[model samples]
Target chain A: MSLSVRHILSVNDLTKKDCALILKTAQNMEEISERSVKKVPILRGKTILLCFFEPSTRTRTSFEIAAKRLSADAVNISSVGSSLSKGETLLDTAKNLEAMNPDILVVRHAQSGIPHLLAQAVDCPVINAGDGMHEHPTQALLDLMTILKVKKRIAGLHIAIIGDILHSRVALSNIILLKKMGAKVSLAGPASMIPLGIEQFGVPIFYDIRKVIPSADVIMMLRIQREREADSFFPSLREYSRFFGLNKETMKHAKKDVVILHPGPVNRGVEIAPEIADGEHSLILDQVTNGVAVRMALLYLLCGAKK
Target chain B: MAEQKLLMTEAQMDKAIHAMAEKVIEDGLSEAVLVGIKTRGVPLAHWLARRLAQITRKTPKVGELDINLYRDDLSEVAEQPIIHKTDIPFSVDNSGIILVDDVLYTGRTIRAALDALIDFGRPKFVRLAVLVDRGWRELPIQAEYVGLTIKTKIDEVVKVMLEECDGKNEVLLKEHFSKRT
Candidate 1:
């Protein structure tokens, strides 16, 4: 009942109970979207700052919409137009925003742990929209909400995460969260793209996507982050697409009711086929829709905790 | 330590619900729909719905409302308000609604419920019913149907437990005891 946890920086910071509570609260938040008048007055007097150091369309817009739907004032500050471009430090930028009296600071940065450092520097609450290759906690939470909505449960399910695991914060957050909730998690991709010591996380590593697909209840396809890659992890995107990318052949290996998920800006032919991305099995857009509700729950929970 | 107080027993609460059901008939609300405030109010609403069905031979529509998002004192209540489901399957347009709850305290909850109910649709008229009415009315609100009325200090807690939820049917009063210095 305390709900004293003020920041959502990583899925690693959440317990199983915390996860369940969030899912339940998000279920409540989803009801507001179904109403004719979707806006709520809970956050009418509150101001939220969306500070992004990296470029984004979906996550940023989803957070903005979530804040607006909650009747909170949402202001977007990107690095391209901000003082960070003028050689200002993250602390200085954050301190300045704190001076403006924002109730919540939702941050996305290219460098991991910036949100954490900002949370420590500011008195108000901080929610990690995404921090580098570290974790996208809200993405993971919305993924959970989507899976729970589609499959009705998370425990005792085979959830296969495919593609670019090393560079994907979505993959890492989902892996930790699914494992915590008693799901069987498996990661498969080009061998070079698989992070070392990932086996220590207790999920099986598979080189062949075909081997993991037949047993997977939920197939989560992670986007190939080419911008973040310093060196090529594969011979070519075509070969990687043919072998590991989910296509018609790979779909044959999956279960009849397998739910396919992708944290998007998807490489239509690389990580997932265009058909599967838009098919009945896809929860990609559901994940996007649930993202707003999950974020609304996070903002409501975290900001309400502030003195 | 403060001694515990029992306000109502299971059978007494059942009789009270029947009486409230009869009050609905007396008020010419045979076509009325019941909307429960979330958590405790939900079970009480269903209980009253069943009682009304027996009294009128027609089951009233039932719904659940969660007022967390409409609450004015969410910051004062808890660090984070635990939001639950707000489900009203039937339309509220031009229909009479009897908002049901377990305990009516400061009337702020009823006020919030009123705000939340409006978001669905405009109702012809909305009425209030509660299992208990412990007075500390911060807002100008009063229940039309109340099972029991108890006077108590501000620090005392009133709890209504339904068998559907808490595995019992009883009303309890617990006085808060501050730690000795």
Candidate 2:
């Protein structure tokens, strides 16, 4: 079956059934990695263009790998190397990329709604890799997949999202997806790190990480957005880690079998302690592995639909 | 809408399966690894394994292969092919592998399955087995073991309904007129 929506710009728009379909399909795609020949012929002869205006490591590489594994020709066009550097606007760049006739487009930009904008301008479907601090749907999906493998379920589970919620696209996407799947999500970070109006989303907020830790079945530690470091959400990294960082003491309060998740490039002792990040409870590596599978599923679904 | 005509009754199906089991036994069953193409082929593989066990008192390894990723007409098909797990726990490098399917038509699906199977490992030998071989093949592929041979037109559909998935045991032929026709 195909995805009902044309563009995956945000998790706010996906239904629970949509999420379930994607996760199931991703499980099937995960097997490709274990094969001696890690490639499929499903998307053969199709071209997938990756347009990234922002600097990224995992998301860009993950999408490219997923496309290639499916035997789809993957073309990367970053803002620096492309015509966008030659005085072309984002819209003009998108139109020119469309002229080449790519089957699906994966986009990442510094500003939010860029994928939404390109989806309207292009005939093919658009998958948002990460559009500012608005949402990173694929990251949330891979997190859910990882959690499912360990915890066996998402419904009725307490998930505490710690650190830099105010600027985390991962936290927002996870909150929306977890809520949709009937999971209890709470925010734990410094006061300034918690986004305002998040209470309207019906999730409780905790300034003290310890308070949220006891009931949390899953602890999702978010990276402190260092690029936005000039804002100074906390007094210093030293104070932030002491109060909100997930150390051995924090782990004691958490569920005995609690699973930890982080969406890449973690600031070791800032959002999470080194011991906890690399410890038995951590699924940090699994999240990265699942990212490729989740992307492959989305590409197959979107491209297979009536374009 | 079209009415279905019963091609094989429950007792007739048992006889057809027995014939298939005898053919596998004759073809060398000691090193056999039965791999079912996903959806209907899975149960067909299990049934053959059980029957083979009854005769030779040895149960062969049964595996499931999903050919969705290897389909030749993936982009041209209207609906997206749903992917399923392709789990072959045993080694395929040097074993007699029998590819099982419920109904064989067009021969393209078997061609796709062959492409998917080879990626797992190099098999000692590979053979094709089908419960029904409807003769309208688009490719040169042929099944080594067949339970029943039926002539079919382009507008007809051959459906094998079993208890494990479809809650019945019978073979039916129906006329299905879609946009393709």
Name the candidate that leads on lDDT. 1
lDDT tens digits, residues A1-307, model 1?
Answer: 5343778888888878778778888888998888888898989989999998898999999999899989999999999978988999989999999999999999999988999999899999899989888999999999999999999999999999998999989998999999898899999988898999999999999999999999999999988898987238888888989988999888998899999999899899888999989998998998988999998888887777745
Clashing pairs in 1: none
TM-score of chain B of 2: 0.95
TM-score of 1: 0.93
Per-candidate Cα lDDT values, in order, are 0.90, 0.89
Which portions of model 2 show Cα errors greater than 4 Å? Answer: B177-181
Best candidate (score: DockQ)? 2
Alpha-carbon shift of residue B9 in model 2 (angstroms): 2.0
CA displacement after TM-score superposition, residue B168 of candidate 1 (Å): 3.0
Model 1 ranges off by over 4 Å: A229-231, B4-6, B150-157, B172-181
Report per-candidate DockQ.
0.67, 0.80
Query: What is the Å distance of residue B46 in model 2 from its true position?
Result: 0.6
